[model samples]
Target: MLLSGQSHAATESRLFLDGKELSLPEKVEIENLDGNVMIPIRVVVENLGFKVTWNQKSQSVKIEQRDKVVQLVVNDLMATVDGKQESLNAAPLLRKGSVVVPIRFVSEQMGMEVDWNNVDKVVSLITPVIEPTIKEPVKVPPTTGSGTSSPTTAPVVEPSVMLSQVNTIQFSENQLKISLSASVQPKISRLTGPDRIVLDLPNTMFSDSFRASQGLDNKLNGRLEVSGYPDVSGVRYSLFSSSPSTVRVVIDLNSAKKYTLLTETTDSTLITVQLREEDSVNIDPIVPNVPAVNDGRKKVVIDAGHGGSDPGATSISKKMEKDFTLAVALKVEQLLLQEPAIELIMTRNSDVYPTLQDRVDLANNMNADVFVSIHADSFSPTANGSQTFYYQRTNSKAFANVIHKYLIKATGFKDRGVTENGFFVIKKTKMPAVLLEVGFLSNSDNEALLFTEELQNKVAQGIVNGIKEYLGIK
Candidate 1:
């Protein structure tokens, strides 16, 4: 039996081997360090058909798995894999007398597979089992959405509902509202390949003028098609399935964003979706906006704050704010790549921490049009909100105001509004800069939402939207 730590063992996560739960002697210390999952060495290595030996003299652990030989020392950042020295993103450490190593490092070295379920907090390992055990796959409901489904369970199907048409798609203060004609509430699911939101209307068909009606023109397949609004790229409807008579409404997104499904109680026909568009660019009334002058391409620097030794905020789920920030920043970086007119620069892409001065120097040296520092806030567990900070002397207040407005709307979190702060990165940068606190990690609900893949993408899009608006990108 392995020894477990005494700190908050009740909420410890579990480990699985080939779909079968392992009875671990100690609570697993599954942590995200440098964006990689770290777990106890004995629990993972021994379970994977490997033999582990502890060397008390050198304070190192040795493992022999098949032909692979690995050595890791406690509190050391270097490991020996088959006599080759390698650097670890996170050092091996002794957690309550038990040694823990990076999960990816050990798994890759041993030729084993590893997977993590953020929602269930389960770490799964896949190894060659002589007697393979078969486990039933978790049942997921039917999804009728046309694009990819977001990382959420399928909504219950209401087979009796009927849809007539999508009446209007409107854009308002940081929201894209879609109104539809329906007899009953529709089931909604979201997906992320090319960024799409899907609506499944049971027992419904398109209206006669659903295709003919046009309010906004968008270029699709070299043809001018009505997109209903500027924020959404295109909308398509299809009979996904005949047996269930499901009509799927697919919203082709121009950028990463979030949505809320609402059905009018008094008028079931009026189904409205509150969408946060990351591509939408608007003039900020709060500050004087300077339009992009050169080549119409805006240069942006995205800084993910805190890394390495800096844990930032610890969430109720035990996720570090640094990990969340980097994850979100990477997602934003991915979405921004789609814009041919935008030049993107990152402060730090990996787990290594970048000094505040280094971040500012990178932005200034690049002559970046704007600099954004992404961070997650920490406060009392009851405090839940998103706020943006700007250096008081610069025009960052305008950038902060614009981005903060869209960010809070996209997150659907309480708005703490834009405030002034002389943070090192924001104050030292010559260009317009803003520091974004996405949400308070201490809040349970906020932490849970932040951990989801969908919300992370949405938050990235919100930051992109702010940049687009500030730069006057079309």
Candidate 2:
């Protein structure tokens, strides 16, 4: 056998920075910090409730939160928290005339761990390390042949590749499943070690070409590593099959190495890894170790802002912002039902008040993809229109902007655009978070329009469109 050669390339993955999500194709590179790891004095301090200011003439970075001022010299590599010298990862690098400090150290100082995984390459700042199970195994099928090799197969027959006998491959909807059959059946066994469990298919000298790829759909983290299996191409996926157990590792090929990633399904959903080459695998699927979000469902967290007698802002006719948020949210529930890909959730579906912290807690528990808080803005009686707000710390500004732009256009309301606000729900949700000030209840024009079913449909349609765009839907 001259070995008919072909290979599958993995898709791309990404992370976020400065409200901008960076798409890293193959590897996530974390540069070693040369400076002392003082809090960035920018990202960390400001995120931790400190006020921030930029001095152009002095080239200084200043922060004030809770009656304390933090000052830092841009090039001097020095700063003071309440007037004290502190270390820095990089001297405040000047960029666009503002002091820019390294992201890792700064986020770390804010009591968070700045992590950049090299395999999938996503920069995540978490309060603690979530040790998601990593599956790494080696399986061997019962082999009795001329002591040579044979071909592999897929459960669904692929007409493109012509091989003698390709073993059947199936995924277990219940427990992990595996099987093997060949003229020369190879030994299939389970292997386990610290933090990994995988199937080892023996006598398979895998031949492959490692090709670098980028994030496929902002969900998958593809990495290529050469393990013994020909099915594994590019960065190998270390799947977690619960330490050591009997699992199937079938090598079916014409010329492709790939891994299938299955996420919870819904309407308006995108299955990115399917039909793509196996060279890419979801190396670091955010395995929810937290029981709160580990139910394995594509979760959503909806927030209704300014509640609990807080009533937020009010209008002359006495249409409370809280009441309207609840009403529209209930309407949104009806609209979202049209698409099964999404699950509808709300901080307050009823008139009951939910604290900002409670909203954040609910969202975190849900492991939300998009955290949306509905509210009515009250700036001035004349200020009428719809707007959206997001936290500058939790990077999702692009997504926020997308929704905000279309919402204003679709609603024909005043355009307040997208903004970064320190609302509690936006500040703490663990996923792509945004808060929509759907309209100005204080504005007589909008307050009257808010109750109309036509306006509700427009807002729902706009929100649905925004979600489709983010998911790269046509």
Q: Each candidate: what lDDT?
A: 0.66, 0.48
Give lDDT for model 2: 0.48
lDDT of 1 at 84: 89
- How does residue 136 of candidate 1 score in lDDT? 39
Looking at candidate 1, what is the lDDT of residue 341?
89
Best by lDDT: 1
Which digits, one per residue and each the tens of the lDDT, describe model 1 over residues 148-175?
Answer: 2121112333445333555444332122
Error of 1 at 112 (Å): 62
Candidate 1, lDDT over the whole model: 0.66
Sum up the clashes in candidate 2: 51
